[model samples]
Every structure is written in C-alpha cells, then in structure tokens.
Target chain A: MARPARRGGGYWVYLIPSLVLFLVVIVVPFAMNVTTSFTRWSGVGTPTWVGLGNYAKLLRDERFWASFQHNVGLIVAMAVVPTIIGLVLAAALFDYIGRRFGTRTASALRAAYYLPQVLPVAVAGVVWGWMLHPSYGAVNQIFGLKVNWLGDSDIALATVMAVMVWFQLGYPVVIFMAGLQRADPALHEAAEIDGASWWRRFWHITIPQIRPEIFVVLLTCTIAALKVFGPIFVLTRGGPGSATMVPSYFSYLNFFQKADVGYGSAIATVLALIIVVVTFLFLRLQERDS
Target chain B: MRTLRAPGGPPGRWAVLAALVVLAVVMLFPFVIVTLNAIKSPAEYSSGGPLSLPQGVYLDGIVEFWQRVDFGRKLWNSFLISGTVALAAVVLSVLNAYAIGIGRVRGRLWILVFFLVANTLPQEALVYPLYYLAKQAGLYDSTLAVIVIFTVIQAAFGTYLLSAVLGQFPREILEAAALDGAGRWRTLWRIVVPISRPTLSVLVIFFFIWTWNEFFLPLIFLISNDNQTVPVALGVLQGDKMMDATMSSASALLGIVPAVAFFLIFQRTLTRGITVGAVK
Candidate 1:
C-alpha cells in the first residue's frame, strides 16, 4: 500500500473557507474603496469618474491638513510619551517593586494601571466627557476652576492628548514588564555587584533586553494613534472647530455626515497609505537593528 | 528562584512603592469618580456638586438609562455578535494556520505576510466599501453584518499569530497522526486543534473583547436601535446629548462593568497571552 501525499494540494482545502471570507470581507471591499476614491458619488447613484478630483480637493483641504497634523500630536501622546513613562513605570514595578516588595504587590499595581484599558474607548470618552464638562465637571469641581477642557480649541487638543496618555500608559507597561521576565537575572546581579547605578542598569540591561517589546509597542501604539476614532466620535466628534480632527474621523465625516463617499474614500486611502509606509519603515528599521 | 535585591535600601524602596501607589490611584481615579457619581441623584448632584458625596444611594439613574436605551437588548446584541465572531474567527484561524503552518503550503511565507499586512490595514480604508456592500447585500442594520465583518478582521490577526505558533508544532505528532491513517480534517480536529487549544482560547478572548468594544463599523452597520451593540448604543446616545450627567455616568458604569468583569476573569490568561503575542 502506498502512503497518500499529505502536504500539497490537500492542505489548500482547509484554507478554502478562510480564503473566501477574506476575499469578500477584506480584499474586495478594500479594492472597491480604492477604486471609489477616483469617482464622485453621494453613495446612492452611480459614481462618476473624476480622475484625480478628490485627491486634488484633499490637497487644498485645510481640514485634511489639520487632521494629519492632529494625528502627529496624537502620536506623541499615544506612543512617545507613554512609551517613555511606561518604561520607567515597568522598570520600577519589575525591578524595584517586584524584587523588593513582592510580585503580588507589583502585579496589583499593574492591574490598577491596566484598568482603564479594559473600558470601551467610547465609554472612556463618556467618562471623561462627564468629568471634563465645562461647568459641572469633576476636574473643575476638584480644582475650583471654570476652564472649558473640551470647548476651547487651543486647549481641546491638549485635553484629548492628556486623556490619551492616561488611556495608553498601561499597554507599554504591561508589554515591557512581560518582556523583562525573560531577561537574564544573572546579568542584573552581576551589574548590581559591580556597583552599576539603577539608572545605568536600566539604560543598559533593561532597555536592550526588551528592545523587541519596545519596538512592538511603539509600532502598534503609533498605528492605533493613527486609527483612533471611537473616542473622537464620542468626546468631540472632531469638534470645537475641528480641533481634535484626525484622519479616520475626517474620513468618517465625509462618508456618513456629508455623504461625500468618494472624498471619504480618498482620505481613507491616503491614511491607509501612510500607515503602510510607516509600518514598512518601522519593520525595516527593526530588521536593520537586529 | 530567589528574588534579586536592588541596591536601594528599604527606605528608598518604600518611596518608590509610594510613588507607584500614587500613580496607580491616579490611573484609577476616573473609575473611582464615575462609580461615586453614578449612584447620586441628579438633585443631589446639582446641589452638592460633582465632588460631594451622595446622602443616599440612587438607582433611578441606572434604571432609567437602562430602560431608555433598552440596554438589555444592546447587551444581547453585543454578546451575540462578539461571541459568534470569536468562535468563528478561531475556527477560521485554525484552518488557515493548519494549511500554512503545518502543511507548509506553497508560497506560505507570502501568504503569511499578506495576512500580516491585512491585519494592519486600517478599518477606515475598508469601512465605506463595507458599508456600501452591506447595504447592497441587505445586511445593513443587522448584527450579522457586524459579526461577519469582525470575524474576518479578527481572524487576520489570529491567523498571523497562530501560523507562527503552529509552524513550530511537533512534527512527530503530526507524522504519527498521518501514519495512523487520520485524514487531514480528522488530524486537525484530533491532533492540531487539541494541542493548540490554549492559543485558540486566547484568540477567542481577544476577538470577543475587541468585537465587543468595536464602534465605527458597528455604528455604521447597525443603524437600527434593535441591532446596536453596547458601545454603539451608548455612543449614539452620548452624541445626541440626551443623557444627563448622572444618566451618562450610569451608562458609563454599565459599559465598564462587562469589560472589567471579562478582564478580571481572564487576567491571568490575558497577561500570559500578551507575552505570547509579543514574544512571538
């Protein structure tokens, strides 16, 4: 009796369900979106091919430029600031707390930090919206001030950024702390024995050991910053004069609110392109670093 | 294993611990305040201000918001959608990973990379077209539409992670399964899936939570009040500016309850899963 071949054509049969679903759900819709970008449509009738009209409109659209600019600031709040703070927090929790006090105490603190991450972003917005309401808000009540946190344009963006930092701080801390577990304790012991300062050991051993986790956190968080929508939708709706407008919310407004489907698709396409480029660049940097 | 002692003495360590405790309290302040105010009567809230403690517990805000939104229906819709997506996505992921990881199918690397890229494709890029397509298919305003979309989207990540995991699966076990005359499907169900159950469970939990928290696509697809998920219902209500402060706090508290419950229940698995995902 001959053994039947098991590894070739037979395996593709298992992939059939996933492949079909992928095509319908992701590939076809994404392709249609890109194709729709070159047309003018109100999303009801046939879309007329406008060539580069939408893209041209986007180029001069001040809102479009402002949205991208807001995204850059969000990158700092959601990614850069959080990563820095998270690194310090994770090191303290892992090295200082976990080692000296107990892992239980460290973990309990980690859970507290992670609590915010468990809420839906929209709910988080609601919570903050209530707390940051111009008149009767908790922040105002606590501080005895009358400042409008989400109403003033100059201050609105910063308010959103601060909230984002609160929302995002836990992620990097969790990831880096997990990564720390795999670090060779002997190296830390040796460094301590040699009288290496805590900061120096953190700079040398802790950071390098978890570089992969750091890269992963930064990449994911940056992408998340770019794609953020729910909080914007709930908190301000990209409002107070588009002060907190982001590319995703901008596209959403065009699609649903304005009924400018073609322009919306174009904005989304640009965002997708930027994300892909950023991801590629990050991966390349990672590969080179390794 | 023995705990390694830091160079800092007990006093310095206590200071660091104090700082961390303060940070943790600040991190949890929103939840603390929300819980505090959610039970306060609007009259009390107005008179005493946001910082003041309630003289009496108030269930009216919570009850009224729940009734106003028919929040039970929304919860069921979210549960139905996220639960279905989680199970279906896991099945889809296992099937795809079995092909690419175990079978080592032709051009597997390219296929894996495609899934990886697909995982990162912003939903904004896909949302409008999906909206259009869903409307065309007569699936608009339906939980099924949200369920289907999330199943595929979540599985992209699941397949990417699982492929890497299943790729390193023990070849001898598979060879033995084959030698025992188990067909491909049988081997998958009996051998591969059983062994990969932990990873699959992790994927299921993640997909469920992610789908439960989804807003944009669900907001688009589930336009009807009957079909809205918890996030969508609360979000639309918030947008409409119809809810009072106590009502909004009550709504926020309700929204936080399920998620926090899931987090507590799966804290260990989640912590372990995050490491697995990151290290892999």
Candidate 2:
C-alpha cells in the first residue's frame, strides 16, 4: 500500500515549530549547561572557563555521591517494590474485587487510589510532613513513637522514599489495570478447564501476558525516581543535612543556591544523559520482545 | 462477575475490597486531616489530636489564612496564568497535531519522531537557559513569561497526545471531504475537528490540571508575589509564617480545592489519561 502516500505537509512544517522550540528550550540549554560545568559563572556576570575542575570537585564531593546513591536507591525502590505491589493489587482487583463490585465501582475505587498522582507535589509534601511530624504529627501518635521522620538523618531518605512510593503507586496501578483488562479471558478459562490452579495460571500465563506493561511501568518509575525533584524540593529540601539529596536536588543546589551554574549544568547534563540511556535500553528490550 | 465468585469465594472478595479501601483511606487521610484542621482555631488545631474534629466551626481560621496568604491575589494569578497557558497550548497543539498527524505530508514521519523524542527530555534540563532567556527578554518576574514558557514546554507533549488521538481517525473521511473540493483548512475545521471533539476535551482537561498544578516553572519564572502561581504562593505562605497551623492548613486546603474538584469531575478520564502512555 506504500502507506497510501502518507498524508499533509509530511515532515517539514510539523517539525519546524516543535523542533525550534525544543532546540531552544532543551538542546541549547543542555549545551549551555555542559559549557557552564566547564566554566565558573555565578547567576550574574560573564563566565570564565575552568576545565574539568567541576567534575574533579564533584569526584571528591561526598554529598554529590550521597545524592547519586540515593537516586539509585530511589530508582530501585520505584521499580522493584512498587511493581510487585502494584501487580498484586491489580491482580486482586481484576480477579476478585473488580468483578464483584462491578466495573463502575471498581473504576471509582481505582480513581480514589490514583488521586494522589493528581495532587501538587507541594501539597503532597506538606500533607505528608504534617502526617509525619515527629511530635505533634499523626505518625508519632499512631505508632506511639517519637521518631523524627524528617529530622533523623538515618530515616529521612527512607521517609522520602516511602512518600514517593505512596504518591506514585496510583499511576502504575492504573497501567496494570489497563493491561489486565486487555488480557485474554479464554486463557484463564482454558487453564481452569484443564484443572490448573489460580496461582499456576497467574504465574505461567498472566505474568507473561502483562510483561510489556510491567516493563513500561518499571521504565517510567525508574525515570521518575531519577528525576524526582519536586517532591523532595517541597518535603525535605534535602533534609536534616544531605540525607534526602538526590541528583536533581544536587543539581538544583549547585545551580540556584550555590550559583555554581557550570557545575550545576554538568549535573543536569549527566542526569539527562542517564535518562536518555536508560530510556533507550528500555525501548530496545521492548523491541526485542516484540 | 461470575468468574470472580467461581474461583475466589465471597470472603476473598471482601478481603480484597477491604485492603483496597484501606489503601484508599491512606491516600485520602492527608486531605481529611488538613480539612478538619483548617476549620479549627490555631489553639484548637495545635492542641487537638491530629485526626480529631474541630470543637466548633469557625470561618476565622480560613479568614485569617486568606489575609495572611494574600490568597485572593494568588488565586487570581493562578487562574489567569494557567487558563491562558492551557488555552494557548491546546490551541497550538490542535493545529500542529492536525497538520502533522493527519495531514502527514512528505516529511511527517521524521517530525512525528522528533516530537516523540522532544516529549521525553527532562523539563529540568531547560529551566536555567529559559530563565536566562526570559531575563534577557525583560520577562523576568512576569506572569506572562511563566505562561509562555509553560505553553512552549507543554506544546510538544500536547502535540504528541493529540496526534495519537488524531491517528485513530479514519483518513477516508478526510479524503472524501478533499474529493468533495474542500481545502485542507476546511477539511480540518469542518471534518477533522468535529470528529476529534472527545480528544480535544481530554486535552483541555489534561492541560488545565497540569498547568494549574505546575510548580517549577512558576518558581523559576515568576518571582514576584503579584505574579506567583498558587503553588509558589503556598510555599511562600508557609515560609512567611511557619508556626500558624490554622493559616497553613487553610492555605493547603485552598491550594487543593481546584485539583480535587477536577479529579472528582473527570475521575474516570484522568486515570485513563495518566496510564495511557505508561505501558505503551
């Protein structure tokens, strides 16, 4: 069919505005950030080049490493734990609750679970902060313990991670629900007819069917964890010292707070690069599966 | 429905529902607490249990919060800035997506691909440069600048989404219109647009919610109190009086009201919208 000669101004017109805007907003800024990393420039005045100094300083920067490690932990937590939990929740909903409660009620319940995703990060953080306030907050009262959720360096990152998981689960759950909806009912019925147990069908058939959705969720969650700036910015602000510092926070501090625009740009560039590489790898895996 | 009871007994169904309800409660707890606290007097808020109700209903806390937070100006600012941004972005995206997605002229494959790539780049990567650019253009501390920057940043994704929706549209309809002597513009307005109403509605809701909730762009672009969006205003209100629980709680409630309203209205669509591309 030769794709029916492919329709409207094809590539040029459609590409121009988006391409120009993106190049100006994304590509140019990214390049500028790389250049800034190499030069020492405050938010004001002209810049002077200082080759590899920022990277060198970053090499010995314990806080930078701490932030980087936290990002890795975040990505892992977002991917592994949430994926399992979301899958279980989705399976339970699809196989049990959803079918009984009726589709409308099931969807309403899903919307309730997904409500957090729509909330502003600032609001989410404050609400969580209030809830986790060590002394007067709900968490302490509920648990009958006086542990400072944000003040304690040891638990601060963990606290941040927990909030992140809670707020983000809604999106993944919806995705899993959609995947479950598309699954072939006949496979389950056939397995049941053959005397296959529910667990066996779920393990051998259900999991494989939704593998693509799983990969998509993992990729998004990882990327989200890597670029988590807003929630951390609002909730802990890198916390009782650098406990909750992630790469995004580190970059923000370097650029805006410290006025080390160059080093900050470098951090931003590295983070972008990491995201691109991760996304590329994810796409490749999907391609292979297809 | 029959399949459910056939395998898992009623107990199993109840157990699942209970767990889901527990998770739902966890999700809603903060909003509930904040609402209850916002209505209480400061002393009442500070002294009462976190989950307890107000001893007496009082608009005083909300009134005090409104004054301290300059919430009237903030709400106005949010409405003006976000409304403009959403409108501009959606309009531009509709034109762009229609042209590129359906009109699929000679080079659209590459353009479509470019847009897809553009959609994935982190918005954080663009902030500093945009900041400097806005400054140079004398847009520093202007609400207009925030509106424009957000509109531009959002255009790519809006195009990406609208195009996906437009892609499902049958080309034969457009072809039929074209054969009937309709020009490209007419075909679009008379044919493509009307059929694309559902997608457009979804985009409208999507952009409205996103622009309303957006924080970073406003934080970076609009520095003045008069120009600040709701999120920035809330942050500043917190910074200004960290101790006033009544004011803080009230401000939090104000900030969430619109989003909560939007969620309630479009609960079904919003969840689907959120998950649309996550698995694809």
Tens digits of lDDT, candidate 2, A1-290: 12333434333454466556667666677677767778889889989889998888888889889988999878766777878888877776776566677777677677777777777777677667666766566678666789988889998888888887777777777888889888998998788789997678878887898989999898878887888877777777887799989888788887779988888877777788788888889989999998
lDDT of 2 at B18: 85
Instruction: Report model 2's TM-score to 2 decimal places.
Output: 0.92
Residue B52, candidate 1: Cα error in Å is 2.7
| Model 1 per-residue lDDT tens digits across residues B1-280 | 3343435455676788899999999999989888888999988888887778888889999999999889999999999999999999999999999999888899898888888878899999999988888888888888788888899889989988998999999999988887889878888899899998888999999989989998988888888889889998888777346777788788889988998999989988898887787777
Q: Which docking band does candidate 1 fall into?
A: medium
Among the numbered candidates, top lDDT falls to 1
- Report residue A163 deviation for candidate 2 (angstroms): 1.0
Model 1 misplacement above 4 A:
B1-10
List native contact recovery per candidate, as a fraction of 1: 0.76, 0.46
TM-score of each candidate? 0.97, 0.92
**TM-score of candidate 1 against the unseen true structure:** 0.97
Worst 10 residues of 1 chain B by lDDT: B1-10
Interface C-alpha RMSD after superposing true interface residues, each candidate, one decimal: 2.0, 3.9
In model 2, where do residues sit more than 4 Å from their true spots?
A1-11, B1-13, B239-241
